[model samples]
Target: MFLDEHTAKQQIVAFAKSIFDRGLTSGASANMSVRIENAWVMTPTNTCFGFLNAEELSVVGLDGTLLKGLPPSKEFRLHKAMYDQRPNDRCIIHLHSTYATALSCISATDNSNVVPTFTPYLTMRLGPIAMVPYFAPGDDALAESVGKVAAKHAGIIMANHGPIVSAETVESCVYGMEELEESCKLALLLKNENANTLTAEQINFLLNKFKK
Candidate 1:
């Protein structure tokens, strides 16, 4: 059955609160959205994630019309880009998580800044993450850049912007992003240390063991 807009809005709002209470979104810096009828349901523009209400959420159709509530998140284009590029993505969680955002500021396309280290947990949850270059907030350029990487990842780090996770369910999307942040935090901690990075052989072994 199709999701009633209000129900989906509430879920997104609840998930946003969870993200904020866990110190994910800070101030008015992050937003959340879910796909709906060729459009997207998202938290309101300029609202704090910790206090979002369904009624305050907005709906933007595929053609970019504001069909319900207030104006949709400033990153509607970002959501649209993912929807367009990734057919399986039903929800998207965008946040300015501290550790992940910190990693974004310094990460590169190379696995070194991602989950290259020997960690089965990160590999299982993130699969392969992507790092997109920074773009001005709310610019179509950001969406365009995201389109190039969406097909390659379940989670993406917006260099200097934060992270966005696209998944089949809102819950899984949030969980995956939490894993992404934790893995990034671990990577940051081991920076410059002699901690053994995950070798191709070790990663392949784990992959084969778990069929990941």
Candidate 2:
């Protein structure tokens, strides 16, 4: 069911609290946004997710105007960039989850698809995980980078940062983020061993069957 503005606000808060309680993100490091009608309800700047109140979430217009609540997150542009590009995506979750953030710090030559196609679930839910070059947090350049990458992929990992996932609903977006974190963890766990990853054909079949 499509959530109204009021319900979207409550769901955003509830999702935030759940992620915070589970250590997906801590302090005020991550940000979330949910589209409602012509505007978006987003987490406020410097507010801990565990303590978020529905009224305190920021509501921003499509044109980037703050319509209500406190100041929007510094990374609001990153969220906006994705929304501007992907009209079908209703929710965006950017989190500094432990495993994903740790994977971001690793050195790699190929920035594209930082996390290899290790699981069918990750491959189906998230196409290729784009790895965007590091930009100062909140930089307009960072948003632009995200926009370019998000044009082709629903999930991306910022270099030395974390993951940003956009989905059709808040619930699925949260689940996708969790899958991303777990996939990253698995990649880290098998960094030394010659892990058996999915073949290109298998990935292609999954993509064809369940492309999101």
Candidate 3:
């Protein structure tokens, strides 16, 4: 279900407002982009999600030209890297959500799948989340690291940064981000407890049954 540019812009605004209102992200720390036929409708740099105007969203060409509106986010390279790796993904959401950011600060035993599978929903909504080692914001290497893993993982957590998720639609991308945040919350909450995470067998079953 490819979206026209107008519809993509509207959806980005609506969902961004919802994400902002719920405190999923704050200030201008987050960015979102929707891939249209020849371009991407993206949140502008330094624009607050709560106050986004659909008309002000950047329309960027595949070659990174700003075709319309304000300049694309400074982290536009991150979005582009993911899109380059996953041709089927239509929307990309990057958020500095609280719990997920907190989780990102910690070292993971497995960088390939940093966030633990606390429940089935996280696995069903998002597959294993890869981890990118910390790099300065807007660093090209950060995008390079993401591109290396984006093909295998729809979700990613950047060390000392936050989560980036992509999906076939804006709604699915938002939902996956929410699930990642919530799963991080659960993981933090159970850090000291003898938490019962889903077994490998169960995870394989879910992957075979529901992975997209």
Candidate 4:
């Protein structure tokens, strides 16, 4: 069932608190959003998720105009960019989680897929995670870069930033973000250990079967 606007606000606050409480994100370093009808409800700019006020969440038009509540997060463009490109995506969760942020800072010649295929759940939830080059916080270019890959990928790690994941529901988006962070942690743990990763064929089979 679709959540009403009021319930959606409460759900956003609840999920935000959960994210902060579980250490999925800390401080005011993350943003979240859910599309409702023609507008989007989002976390306010610079507000700590742990202490979010349900009434203070921002509601904005698809064109980015602020309609109610506090001002939208500075990363609003980032969220809008993804939504503009992918009609199927309804919720977005952006977090500066510990391990995922660490992986984002790694210098890589090939910045294609940062998270290796270490688990079936990761593959099913996040697909091929892409990497976008660094752009200063609030830069529109960051949004543009994300838009380029958002259609094909369910999640992406911004260079020197962190990850942003979009899914059909807020719950699924949070789950995908968690899967991404865990996969990144696993990748770091297995570094230089010659860990066996899923083969392309195996990954393809999982992708075909799950169709996340």
Each prediction's whole-model lDDT (CA) = 0.80, 0.90, 0.94, 0.90
Model 2 TM-score, 2 decimals: 0.97
- lDDT-wise, the better of 1 and 4 is 4
Top candidate (TM-score): 3
**Could you tell me every candidate's TM-score relative to the true structure?**
0.90, 0.97, 0.99, 0.97
Per-residue lDDT of model 1, residues 10-108, tens digit only: 898888888889887789888888886677888888988899878878888879899889987788889888878877677888888888899889847
RMSD of each: 2.3, 1.1, 0.7, 1.2
Off by over 4 Å in 1: 107-113, 202-212
What's each prediction's clash count? 1, 0, 0, 0
Better of 1 and 3 by TM-score: 3
Candidate 2 Cα misplacement greater than 4 A, ranges:
none
The sequence of per-residue lDDT tens digits that candidate 2 reaches over residues 5-123 is 89999899888999999988999899999998889999999999899989979999988899999999999999999988889889999999999999989876677777877789888
**Clashes in model 2: which pairs?**
none
Which runs in model 4 stand beyond 4 Å of their true positions? Answer: none
